[model samples]
Target: MSTQQPENTAPADRKVILVTGASSGIGAAIAARLVTEGHLVVAGARRTDRLRELATSTTEEAARSGGALEPVRLDVTDRADVAAFVQGARDRHGRVDVLINNAGVMPLSRLDSLLVDEWDRMIDVNVRGLLHGIAAALPVFTAQGSGHLVTVASIGAHEVVPTAAVYCGTKYAAWAITEGLRQEVDPSIRVTTISPGVVDSELAHTITEAGAAEAMRSYRAHAMGPDAIAAAVSYALAQPADIDVNEIVVRPARQR
Candidate 1:
């Protein structure tokens, strides 16, 4: 005779998570996936209409699975908006569990193109925007004595490519800064760095330089899908609370 045993499963505590740049692409994908996982997600982006659509769709899907979403209009470039959104999330959820800094721009251009304006925009959004998220969420994490910060850097941060030097530089800074944040935060605070290689998204569409745009066409041809990243992020969060997944790089197996 054998006695039946119950399967052990982790308790599902509703985790409050904020995901930025969520109007489309990877950010939106992460937000959508998390919502489906029973997490209370605060999805944000500059495009209010797109954000609204994503929110509604997410809510409807979540409702089917017995969950919901909280949407907020945010331009991560605006420090005030970042701060306010963090505060608002805490107001609603009672505490912050995770912050996914996913807003970024890949307006790749060769140095010869001298698209310094595009360079600046990439830096402002990819680097500074991530910093603002850290600044906004760190305090909340510190107060709670526990939290998680996930930054979506790029594989370009690992290998510099044609017409991607400056964009890579910004990502390099982003990777460095996020690592620094993780080192300084409390042991209870988990930090995950998700560096994905070319992903099927609108990321390349932002490239303004003609040559750079053409160059990226070949790269996107080999890029991975955004769900690969969404899965990575979800895995990082699903780990035991004490574990801090310092970094996870999901690049195409075909990528060099």
Candidate 2:
């Protein structure tokens, strides 16, 4: 009821933000940037070894920035893993102020190719994984009375391209699902979706089709760096609480 300036106490006063797929690429960049901004960052990934390495780097960065980073092993596709990771993050940090669901797979192939296996993988890791993130964080958000959901999608979600039907579908689903979640959640919870176009990352490495992978590699050669997207995310988070920055599309200047 009071518009109060909560004291920025110890590291705990900073928002406990959790970022998925933080071992590398955009997620990692975001985690580091938030840490640099003096927020407590929880970095989660499927690779525990990579998590360990990132934890070490985060610790050094935290020492330099006067913040803290907690790293955890998480597989978003596994519901149990998601639950456990969310619980562990809350237990370690005492609260979750933000969740960036950035884990996804992009295995592009022509629909004629069927690529059922690839399709399933994309849906599981991209759509269902995001759902898992919401399931894990929503309760905490409700109890805390303030939180944020930041999701990573792609420009393909709004447009269509060859040999990327399924991938686009999943991203589109993410786009819609996040919007729906935003519409349904109480005003206290902020939901933001970031759709990036051709930012440099290893997403193309997961493509199974030779032609598709090569084409994507060519586009990636000219793509924006992950730091660009990180900046956009930071901007969204740094905004005033009442101004729920809903959606942002970060693409290279030449990506059009």
Counting clashing residue pairs in each candidate, in order, gives 0, 0
The numbered model that scores best in lDDT is 2
Task: For candidate 1, write residues 1-256 as lDDT tens digits.
Answer: 7765433221367688899999899998998888877788888988888878887887656765444567789988899999999999998779999999999988888898888788889988998899899999999998999999999998877889888899889989999998888888779999889999889999888887888888888877787879999999999999898877889999889886
Q: Write the per-residue lDDT of candidate 2 for residues 144-242, one digit (tens) a residue.
A: 999999999999889988889999999999999999999999999999999999977778878888888877877776798999889989998888889
Global CA lDDT computed for model 1: 0.87
What TM-score does structure 2 among the candidates reach?
0.93
Error of 2 at 233 (Å): 1.0
**lDDT (C-alpha, whole model) for all candidates:** 0.87, 0.87
**Residue pairs with backbone atoms closer than 3 Å in model 2 (clashes):** none
Q: How does each model score on TM-score? A: 0.93, 0.93
